[model samples]
Target: MALSRDRMIEFLKRHDYDPNTLQSMETKEIQEAYQEVTKKLLGSYFHLTNDNKSIKTNSILLDMGELTEFKQKLKDCANDVITLIECLQEGYMKFDYSEVNDLLAIALKDMPMHKMQKISHIAYRSFQEILLSQIATALKGLPKEEFKVLEEFYEKRRNDTQFLHQTIDKLKDPATRQQILTMARVKLMVVKDFMPSNLYDVYRDYYNNVPQKLELVAKVRALTGLYSKEYLKEMPFEELETLYQDILKHNEQEEQDRKMFLKYSQAIQESVDNNDDEGFNEICYKAVTHLTQKQLSMLVEYMNGQNPFFLSKFESVVHEYKKKLHIKR
Candidate 1:
């Protein structure tokens, strides 16, 4: 598929290329320009150095076709980051990290150790401040004495090369390394609120098996909305385990609710097709009991184009149920 012109312009402008340059360029020229700019922006992550000789000797080399694929993978990550930032701004913190994880795995295929190290160094240098600032904002409510540990650790990681190397070396053990990666993936799947940079810190703490002040455990538990980070920091390990269990249970319930709603939606559609008002009313009644107000509203919206009569009946059922709940309260 062709890239959207506006998105191409935005991407070019982001990399300091003037949008006006495209005015004189044909579509093919614009596509080539976008590809060249993408490679220039993302090349450092895969290439050890810009010098051809050095890249050949020290980096995992990709042919032209492979490089095109690699660029798309990096572009996928860039797009995910943009979506994540927008969602964060809108107060929807949950995200599915699996797609990004798969993309990164492909993008990093055959990447040399030195290249990985270089990418880590670049991430630390270029992205760490933004990540730390975001973390500070999220954890601002915590006591200064407690928050200081997190602040100091990030500062040391950036400035103290020895400390950083020592920390990285701890992951050299194959079993420990696999365990850390596995834990990071599992946490990403379950926690659902972490940014990419946050996974870096998560891997470090997971390898050490030490509970840092802002470690995944605390972050995951805090996301439950049942506890503050301040409270979680002091909470017993057993209680933390309980909170983890609660999170799993809540996630399971949500999945079940989603499946139920989908089934009812399909049944409603079938009822509409058959012109069965009786079946439609019955389905709406049962759906209201199983689905939340928001879910019911979504169902109403979905029905609007399918059958206006059914949509009105579903709305009436929803209103009646809500009124009954209010009276019970």
Candidate 2:
């Protein structure tokens, strides 16, 4: 079976996929391939890297911390959030993570690595620990003259909203952010490629364990009328299956969610037509709702792993939907 290239790309990104390193490959060649494809998939966020680590640069608002400001929009748009909640309160929705990954990678290519690291609940924790430790350590006993360079970097990032959010009591110094990133690269330049599966597995466990949080997340659908943008940000597919199945047993699941879930399944029958691996990722992400973790994992794995990549039969099914969308467009 063909692994969904777009989906794989996203998984890599969310997992901090070191685009520069693949198993048994040169960093330059691997980075080149990703840089080329990312230009198409991610748009302009892609940038050349002198050192291996440092990640992407934030272009939109100028600071790595500005990302936290966007969260305000989500809260302020209560009606929108409620609409999303209402739909989800009714049934299980399936979403794919890959689409969210794509949206994020492209959107954040020019975004700060510090903020990007904090985007996912799972990744966010790591982002904070990693960046903070790097920065706090980098700043210890630094020379005053060097602070001039640090001052320049901070000036570029002083007004970031996301930064304020993460450091509600303080603003993350942009120079510190950048320097910490640089330091991280110096330490980790050699280690790259697929992240350890154990990290993801633990992420899945945390996601499954948090019932109140999951319910609250589902509320985001009702509150905003929009499903989560990233595919299962909290855990892996196997984790979702287990979580979803367990939740399904607790109560009578909504019929509408079932319908939406089924429709999503039909819509994403194949990868060729889906285009946005992240989009499918969003669907599968939503789909995991109301299932036991095992069930959620099983269903998602089946959707991503079992289906034929671009079978003619699947293509014909897509043609039918494409015609309708064409009319709508």
Candidate 3:
């Protein structure tokens, strides 16, 4: 039995594939192109991560926040299709929808596993937008001087709009859009690796200062049996000597823990710089135990740049770590 053009397009769209991409390929090549693009898209979906959290489920279940963002990205992705059609109608591309559809049907036969990969790249793009937004928010908390440095960094590259917007107004060719996206990802990865150091400095100060405030509260609570500052003036100090001593002991231990963490972080950086694999591994083991998703991303970027093969090693380590920690989607 021969497949109808309309039926083939329906199957592709139902499985979240971009049917319009067929227009870009020759009549005899649509099947090969569809198969290749679908495989690549599925692979991307399998590796999808948000803040170091792996998404391993076969289906996407988004929260309200994610749903809203996904809708916007889907809209943006759809605009590309509309723009392509408009350009083609305006004589930019010498093809129409009917011709492409007819060719795609003849090329694409019945294929199973289409429903299993229902999530489209457009949805994944939205997820990426959320991840990027989180990264930007993390970077925004840098100290004023460091933030100024980032601002200057952006200012330096402000005029380079070659890959800034993915809209059709700038990129008329679908192939060029794909090529630019590939290059942009590499630059984004490098930026992800470098920008976190400034944020880490600010976070380190926060981690150090918070314990001081906690210590002060502990001291006040010990002496006056009061946890609020408003009651400090009215407290009768009978010198609760034992209580004061206990508070001091606890604060000392807390300070020691902070110092240990600082030492470990320093060791990781030194290990990377000096090419000390064992030392880096030791510190990374300790650091990964407490690292947030943002920190893990930065570390991956750092390691990947140090050695081309390190990205796979780091990913394997993280996979094991996630399993050990029982971190699920």
Give Cα-based local distance difference scores for all models.
0.53, 0.42, 0.44
lDDT of 1 at 53: 27
- Ten residues in a row with the worst lDDT in model 3? 161-170
Model 3, 62-107: lDDT tens digits are 3656434433433343335444233222221222224323322332
Give the winner by TM-score: 1
Model 2: per-residue Cα lDDT at residue 53: 36
Give per-residue CA lDDT, model 1, range 1-329, as digits (tens): 34676766665676677668866667777767777765553343223111122111234443656445544645444435444233222211111133323444465565565654444444434444544465445434433432454455545554433333333444345564444343333334322332454433433333233455447466566557777666665554556667777788888777876777688889999987898978887898788787878677776676776776776677787788788889999
lDDT of 3 at 11: 40
Tell me how far the alpha carbon of residue 45 in candidate 3 is from the true structure, in angstroms, after superposition: 87
What's model 3's overall lDDT? 0.44
Error of 1 at 327 (Å): 16
What is the Cα-based lDDT of residue 41 in candidate 2?
33
Candidates, ranked, TM-score = 1, 3, 2
Worst 10 residues of 1 by lDDT: 48-57
Model 2 clash tally, residue pairs: 73
Error of 3 at 91 (Å): 99
TM-score of each: 0.29, 0.18, 0.20
Output the TM-score of candidate 1: 0.29
Off by over 4 Å in 2: 1-177, 185-194, 198-237, 253-329
For model 2, residues 236-320, the per-residue Cα lDDT tens digits are 5455455556555533345544555566566556433657665654444444444556554444455656555533434444465
